[model samples]
Target: MSEPPKERVKYIDTNLNLPYHYYAGDYKALYLRALKDKKILGSRCSKSGKVFVPPVIASPETLAPCDELVELPHRGIVTTFCVVNVPVYGREIEIPYVVASVALDGADVSLYSLIQECAAADVHMGIRVEAVWKPDGERQGDHTDIRYFRPTGEPDAPFESFIHRL
Candidate 1:
């Protein structure tokens, strides 16, 4: 009698090393340039007076044209977040790091970034945070210029203020 054939493998789990570049258009190019100058810029919609970080050409919500690029404060509020247990391919950070969506003080929109300088357990929605920039000489005209966001001692935002918009 023939032995039962081995069950076929149903899945394979592995990581792929895919290198790629994000096509940055005019608006994004301007924003990325400002990073080299240690400035944070947001696009403002003339119609709604809403500003978006990592400036876009139009407002995602209202679909209004954003013609103005305004400098934004480095401080922002944590709108939401998740603790990441999986390690990044080349980054050396330990497992269980916090990735958060930060709502800059003046911008209506939020940008996602890493959270550091404190335990992951303490990260939460509405927590105030300030960007920790790489030293001037180390900046390379990219989001990497801002190493991470660290908690600010200031009070957390009132949920009502941001909750209404989200």
Candidate 2:
């Protein structure tokens, strides 16, 4: 019998655009509303006294419903961070930026946000940073309302200050 030739497999590359709507519950709606005003709001748990930024409906630790809303300062400490060097889809910022976990003042929970206006090498745990808001007209009820955080030139926070957040 004669040998038969093998056929090679072909691969097809494609992209998909999915349109969908996200429903933000009352807690998130209020939080985003405050963002539009260039303000950060946190939810406080009466029992545990933990405050969550981007306010939550329930206490993360105890899972108890939280009802009190507290306004938070834009300034916070960088509890930890890492530099982004690799490019990935859906990234709006330029490559090599720093994403840090911040512990805002008066809030028990920490919020994660992009760190900017400083050298990546200069970023470190406990660095003080304050939000740089977008112009009033540019805000759209989102976290992006705060363009990014910049160095406040304040002394670094002691490890004990933000350890619980970690």
Q: What is the TM-score of each candidate against the true structure?
A: 0.83, 0.86
lDDT of 1 by residue, 46-145 (tens): 7989888889889877899999999999998998899999888998999799999888898887888999999999998899999999998888888898
Candidate 2 per-residue C-alpha lDDT over 32-72 given as tens digits, one digit per residue, 9 for 90 to 100: 88899887999998779889887888886898888899999
Colliding residue pairs in candidate 1: none
State the TM-score for model 1: 0.83
Error of 2 at 127 (Å): 0.4
lDDT of each: 0.89, 0.88
Q: Evaluated with TM-score, which candidate comes out highest?
A: 2
Model 2 — which ten-residue stretch has the worst lDDT? 1-10
